[model samples]
Target: MKRSFGLAFALFVCTFTFAQQALWGGTSIVSPEIHENNTVTFRLKAPKAVKVQVTGDFLPTQKIKTPFGDFDGPGAADLIEKDGTWEYTTPQPLKPELYSYTFLVDGLKMNDPNNVYMIRDVVSVTNVFIIGGGRADLYKVNKVPHGTVSRVWYNSPTLGMDRRLTVYTPAGYETSGKNYPVFYLLHGMGGDEEAWIALGRTAQILDNLIAQGKAKPMIVVMTNGNASQEAAPGESSLGFVSPNMQLPKTMEGSFEMAFPDVVKFIDKNYRTIKRKQARAIAGLSMGGFHSMHISKQFPDMFNYVGLFSAAIMPDNNVKSPVYADLEGKLKAQFAQNPALYWIAIGKTDFLYKANEDFRKLMDDKGYKYMYYETDEGHIWKNWRIYLTEFSPLLFK
Candidate 1:
């Protein structure tokens, strides 16, 4: 009886060990398999899931001319399950670009566990993959000199708190011992300092451009423009607040009032060109609004100003007392004789009319500015393109 019991226990141990190995070994299964033809295959091992679907920007709507007419809609197809695994493949080749995707398993959205490359945009998180070559190659880490990105904290007297900002120093910054021009890059509403680096691919773009001798080497500073918050969502001392709460009125002017403090801190801490000619400020959407107000308030602070899909308000629609004298302030700002006041927007953007009216205002005031129009609406695709074009024109 003792011999039989001992033999039984040994068999049990072996069975348990094999089961554990098999369970964990399945984790190596690759879900997103990028093919040489630029087509991608996504797989998910959710045997018990009732439904599964994959969606991404790469599955943009296509026009299909049916017997009745043409219909434009999503091209992505649902994943079919087989042998306890759901799989999907793109019907056609995708363009070379960074794309974000998510999987829906039985109506529950989830990230691709197999793909470790992920990014957060505002409230949503998604897995990402890159199709190499072409313009997307510019967004990839190439065999060129790279820049160092750092998250730096500084005191903000205007907001009466310490804040965090993302700074990108060029590759040779430590050894160059030369003062580099600075670019104050801001993100749209619902975005923070990380937006430019994550979604905009600023570091990769700068590295490629500088290496190609297309853009001048400069420091890019990305700041959190949400004034009520001391830092990005998770980093804020006030803690995470729901999206519905009304921000304090003081938050509206906090960044504008603290603009000087930011400049002073940068100049004192980093090796930067102290003159306005060596400085540039640009942003997208709400950030564009801040840039406009910041440059208007401190006319001599930045020589090159860019507004990408800017949220420009009409004179009467201006609510903040800080911009009460918009026209007069802008007139005075232009009088400072800055080098470039560039505005860019997509034709399909909802703010197109607003930008048009703002451009008309600039025209009426005889303020020299550059205007650029593109093909998309208010999206990150256009914003990235705008940055690619805008950065080359800066510090020239």
Candidate 2:
């Protein structure tokens, strides 16, 4: 009986160890392994899969056609099989940046089984890895003193609901007990309070920038730009409704009108500099549109304004005073002499023409503004870069 009990106990321990190994692809297997040369190797244990491929932002983009037009999208690389595992290594060293990828097993899309790091962008989820020794290092947590990121609830009388926001108080905020400036970072269409923190790496960027003395230590308030949704899907009482691209009130005037509620709530709650000179507003794509309209509608609210790949013109059919009087609002906004009115867009963005028209309109009006152009289209990579660049110029 003693011999049997001992054997059984040993067997159970071995089984448990094997289960743990199988769950995360034990010591023998690793999905994404970044090499010293900056090349990446991806491996998958797909003994049965006839074909497997890896797709990610690291690969060159291929032109994909959509209802709008052809646009560049992430391409796939085929993996070679050896024994029971499939593997592939990039031929060239990838640039030092954060990249997300997924495995395609026999034509089915799936996340990496071995690597657990991942983030959700509006509606899609993908595994992510960073190649450090460059700008991507800012996104990684280092030895610097990190700030406190809080999910705070605020009552929005204008919207008639309690909404959620992700706020980042710089390091030493609680201990120092001094009022700091605030930067309102909005999100693009289909994004929520968590978007900038997740996809844009807002917290990491601000933390690193502040530590390096490149940016002012300020509070960053990331709000749920979708006026109809109180928060990110599954975050509110919405009950796990899958996020989609067809979010309502994304660019409507409702969000712009209710923007002051967010500002007032932050000022009243946090130790904040309540004046316009200390306030900055910026966003990407749809969020950029909101920032532009919000700042113009209340020019005294933010002395610093940034439009990152902004949808310059409002939909002609959306009848609202916020979208009305295109030049009149700018005239009032500029007359106050805001510290900065900046615009930036990707060269190949579908909205490139619209941004150019916006620039032309500002030029014709003789408005003093700054413009920046990049190589990519309307994507998060550019948005992340924009945030890094824009934050340094704020409150300086």
Per-candidate TM-scores read 0.87, 0.96
CA RMSD for every model?
A: 5.7, 1.7
lDDT of each: 0.85, 0.90
Candidate 2 lDDT over residue span 1-396, tens digit each:
999999999999999999998875676687799898989999999899999999999998887887644566899999999997999999999897889999999999999878889999877899999998677888888889899999999999998999999999999999998999999998887788999999898888999999999999999999999888888899998789999778777776889999999999999999998899999999988888999999999998999999998887666787888988979999999999999988999999988998998999999989999888999897888998888889999998
TM-score of 1: 0.87
lDDT of 1 by residue, 1-396 (tens): 999999999999999989997776647667789888988999998999999999777787455564422433234558999999899998898888888889988888898878878988777788988898877888899999999999999898877888899999988998999999999999887788889999999999999999999899999999988776677777777677543223343236667778788899999999999999999999998789888989998998999999999887523543666677889999889999989999999876777888999999999989999999997567677888888899999888
The alpha-carbon deviation from the true structure for residue 171 of candidate 1, after best TM-score superposition, in angstroms, is 1.1
Residue 108, candidate 2: C-alpha displacement in angstroms: 1.3
Report how far off residue 153 is in candidate 2 (Å): 1.0
Off by over 4 Å in 1: 1-25, 61-76, 238-251, 314-318
- Those runs of model 2 whose alpha carbons end farther than 4 Å from true positions after fitting are 1-5, 8-12, 15-19, 22-27, 67-70
